[model samples]
Target: MTEPADAKAVRAAETAVAAEAPDGAGASIRAEHLVQRFGSGRGAVLAVDDVSFELDREPARIVSLVGQSGSGKSTIARQVLGLQRPTSGAVTYGGKDVLRLNRKQRSEFRRNVQPVFQDPYAIFNPFYRVDRVFWTAVRKLTDLPNKRAADEAIRDSLRAVKLQPESVLGRYPHQLSGGQRQRIMLARIHLLRPQFVIADEPTSMLDAQTRRGFLDILQDFRVRYGITTLFITHDLSSVHYLGGDIMVINKGRIVEQGAVAEVMAAPSHDYTRLLLASVPAPDPDQRWTERIDIGQIR
Candidate 1:
């Protein structure tokens, strides 16, 4: 992490900053001057360039990060998850610089923020029981009493994602529908009860019906656990449906960011207008499987 900042020095800076902007329990996550680059200082590819955002209050509020491929949304999400250290800035969870955290602190923060990756089909193993995924998560994150207590926690967690726990038990990932498997991923995080979820294109791989259902299920989780979400997608219509606030990114930069209504109704940035122009219109003649991809936008 010293490739970006010295950890001891960062702790001191965090201490000073926390004294100034004491967000208390309201601040779930925050990123300041977040930059992710690959290569050297003078010449490098900028994956995420000085991007800064925060989620304070609005416990279950949903925010969507919309951008083309390589626009840095995923990179920023990784930074928020503490997977990648920032090249320059800082990412903080509850007043501390999380990138500087030790193993114990890192594990604790992980329970607060978990990722729900796209492509649910690839999210699991054919070898291990699907329940094993959840069980392993529980083992790593918590120390419950016994198998019964762990099983109870698993059941409650699956129920949170609208899954029938009994139906999914002892099943392999390949046996479940794409939706069910994705729900299992959500269920795993719910078991941990993370305060925020960074969902990277959670619905991209599903069919239209399943995609809509995915949205409903996630919204249900929000209602159940009061989980704030940084929902990442390239779909404008999906954003219209689920986003409380919208941030449009282009080539590793934020073009516009604000409430969904204001941003979409009157998109000031050209890139955002491009996104608006690019929403698929319903055509009865077209195949229902018509998909939205990065290439479709002009």
Candidate 2:
């Protein structure tokens, strides 16, 4: 008897997951007293001011960092991903500092923590076919035996994100819609099954419908694969839709942090209230009537 292609892909993914699963107790990624200051002296700007948070490896969750532009939410994301070093504080994974990890540990850290960045087009090369991204990841990250296994895994990952392999595999970035490109990034996340997904304003470039779909996919990732997400966005509605922990950031600080419903319903911080008030009501009759003065809120 012969095995089916889909079944083979499934078995391969299962094997990969089992092989890569962390040994011993679960771990966490923690940011302690992080501060990112660009430049020097009086001219120095504090991008991330003493920000701290943790994402645990077990019991996957989605924690949203909500803030307007320049609030330092994206900087926090970068810090967590180990892309940018903080001025003072530390980003640690499994009790080891990310910045100080050795080559082997760093490779493990990179594999365990992946990012779905804001601009889909910017991540892809204009000249290369879309398949290159997956192939590169497979070659660099995975221990798959051959090209056949890699191709099957890539196809399976695409299907997991609800993208048809034939439609997406060979096309260039320009050939795909923004939604498709973004979904391909999600597909990559699915393929890797990283413990933490740093989604920095992933839906900003998407339309309302597409944005909703993208959020749904993030939620699906949490539920199905136990993947934790640091979902960074300026959109309060998206935060509400995501429905988990929410941290409201203002001027490089976390003004308030709590469950989404609790924070949305009764925000303690003035900045949080202002952010909530800024969200437009679905019904025209219940819309915000008064003009918001930004100068008054801080």
Candidate 3:
């Protein structure tokens, strides 16, 4: 497939930025001893417990944080995106603390590190046309000279995600299908061409086929645009499909970490094993025989 016009523009912009930046400028997002606590005294809940990981910028790849719901996976993402400050520890981007970045640095960080959140419906305004999202992004994040340039960029971005511009541009959030709305978010990412993507359960709301397509696009971004992703999810099937490094968190702790294939083949932690076993088998002839005690893992 031919690269989209907007993609070409992003490539040119990236090249320009690379030329001006100094050597060893490919910095990573690092979380050191991260801890997030909510409430107080005996009721205080430790959402994240000493979670430490590094998302490197070189050789772009997907690193999945897998766990059950309320397992601190999303909390870690919030910290990484500077949406919420950790109670203890730090989230640093390019060797500087994310919370402490200056205006310029913060702007650059926001541009370079973007998010694809879980709920597509919640991302847009029902009161306005869906095009507003793209227009707002163009106005704030891009230096497109005029309305014509912005329009072209938006059209090309929609095309890049396999959405026809005419069908999607003027519709409200309620007018589009779930998959189309999610792909619109992906198109936004394609337009921005961010170095890192914080995809928090981006495919959970899509159908099986749509979910696969979404994962394929993420892989393509890594291959074509070098957009590394921190894929946060509870689905072991999705984790196995998007094969990369895997970190298994259970009860606010990283119980196991390794390559997806390796960990899937021989999971060291019981929680990891439970997650893998939970994945439904494709063949009806294969019966699930393992009995799990929920209390034991906890």
Candidate 4:
């Protein structure tokens, strides 16, 4: 089914707002002096040191948090998605202080700002149908009854993510390929129809070719659905393809922030430059292992 003209226009208007820079009022996501540390004993480590940025949010703007393994890219995502709270800092979303909200207070914000995790493979359970995720979504967002509305919602979500529901509904997680499973996660976002999506390394597990293809899918979603996105990745190469505005993080701090092309062309900080230099050039003789294991995250 096609999106309605009014909906499309609303999305377009939202897109316009998101595309605005920091000078305007469209900063949908803002983090101020954000600090996140893990463990309080002898082994305490800083996950996100002092990250800060104002991202224009609506539908069209695509912001990337690029950094190294310990740069706290995913950590920032968690704080924004409300999966984790900052040890000391403030995250204001649409004029609401995220930390101030109780479970019931934050429900609407939670629905508006959903998350797409890194491991697409682990998104679903093998014992349940793919719709189980949607079941949880329905329970949280709407009061849909019976199989019919639920199934239709699932199918529509699948369509938004460019997957055929008939091919995927009853299938187990193991039945689909890596990229397909990731798209299914995207489908869940479509059902939720969030204003913003915090995608924490959503395509990180895929091969280089698949990863590149998945970028288009995400961009299309941002454009078509008018969903603002926080695309977080440790790799800098992805910035060129996905980032409209860039936030370079290192040792838990935001070292740089600006337009994607400008940041790529002339990165101000040495750390950001080092990151830009690290993007694997498309060399014919180069082999792609695409493995950057940073140990098991808790």
Candidate 5:
């Protein structure tokens, strides 16, 4: 997007958000019977099959979407981020249909809803300085009088993500480590404080230690700013650590969903049970095995 377009989008978003008074307690993001299919007729493939869920933003929370590859997790994430249009159903933010939003509404949605994809490098331009993303965001997201004020705001946001300004400001994307890049993306999101955030495999690339810290960062942001998040991943442990509801998807359909404790204790669906069992146990004597008979269940 051009700088002018970015500025316009930010302005429109701010206006729309300001126009609506905070209702305080309600569903912030909702997906109503979403279905996405590729191709048509007999050859059609259902990428997301009749999925529905809600991410409550009023009190701030994390909602986990867990599924292995090809289980429709990423497809659902794309739909929620407005990156893809489902063949059926709708995704709404504050009761506004995402697919049918007007230009102004689109701007508001753009500002209020943000996404962090799995690959951090994919989100940045290698030619530009790493800090360019933050600077551009500040210019478009806020109306600070001059560059100095924007720079200060940028520094503050960087600190929130534990990034030192001088260390990364002049570096190119290639110069930074994968973890650093991911943190930068988080910092960008923190600066915006969007109403809803969609994170898809955000920590999959990080080491175990880094992944734990990354999850903590997300938790900190949630506690500090009351930002709602939809965390998409294949890791059940991460979901358990994040502390939110879990939705298990299989072949584009949500087979089971409920509070973390309830579902983890006793998963009803075979797919869900299989997913939980797949989590490795620390004790060698307690190694997990598929306790369910998948053939009979399906």
Candidate 6:
């Protein structure tokens, strides 16, 4: 189905925002001393407190922000995505502060920076065909001039995500499993070919087999497309699987951060050690209740 002309024009305007910048030129994303607070007085809460980090373009790295619930990881992701303004500090792409960008620059930012949200079901409309999600993204985010070309692009992306277009094209969201829906999300992102991706628990909903498959595709993108990713999740196992830098956040503060190997091998901070110790082991004797010290929880 073709998109309405008005909707198509809006999409064109959004993608055109970054037309001046050569595609893929903006490689790095940096969060500088960001602080996001809500409410005031006693009711006020600091969600992300003075968190700063950078995702470098060189090596096309995956940066994992690991934290328990309420650690403010999602808040930081939102700040980076330009969905929410920080109370202080800034998120910059290629050295330009995202929140401070003009309309055109903001549009460019949108085109280059894409997000794969935590809930695949929440991202799609139940009423539309699953393929509609892919085609709609093509209509708005890309400039493939004709139907034939667009179909080829869609087919390639679906294959990349391990979804056969013939099987998934005419189906609705409910007709697909959680894993298939997540793959669709990845396929949509593949079509956009964004420089940086904000992946908020992208694999959290899938089963073991499907989870690994989804993550493999993501790793492939990092290696092949040179896409830098801000991977946010509560799973330390996933962090280890992705094999990148790890930043451990606790109660809105960064408890520890460094290369995944370095942090895992010798966690200097109390919270980091606590997180590592909390990981469940296959040995029945290695119970978390016994290994974890209650005193170090701060």
Which residue pairs show backbone clashes in model 1? Answer: none
- Tens digits of lDDT, candidate 6, 130-149: 87776667665677878899
Lowest-sum lDDT 10-residue window in model 1: 13-22
Please state the error at residue 100 of candidate 4 in Å.
2.0
Rank ordering of all candidates by TM-score, starting from the highest: 6, 2, 3, 5, 1, 4
Tens digits of per-residue lDDT, candidate 3, 110-145, equal 777877777777767689898987876776677777
Off by over 4 Å in 5: 1-27, 282-298
Q: Between prediction 1 and prediction 6, which has the larger lDDT?
A: 6
TM-score of each: 0.84, 0.87, 0.86, 0.80, 0.85, 0.87
CA lDDT, every prediction? 0.74, 0.79, 0.79, 0.69, 0.75, 0.77
Clashing pairs in 5: 49-252
Across 194-290, the per-residue lDDT of candidate 2 in tens digits comes to: 8888888887777777887899999999999889999988776677778999988888998899889999889999888788777665453432232
lDDT of 4 by residue, 159-205 (tens): 87678888987888888888888888777777766677777777677
Q: What number of clashing residue pairs does each candidate have, in the order they appear? A: 0, 0, 0, 1, 1, 0
Consecutive 10-residue window with the lowest summed lDDT within model 2 = 1-10
Rate residue 227 of model 6 by lDDT: 85
Candidate 6 Cα errors over 4 Å, as ranges: 1-26, 281-298
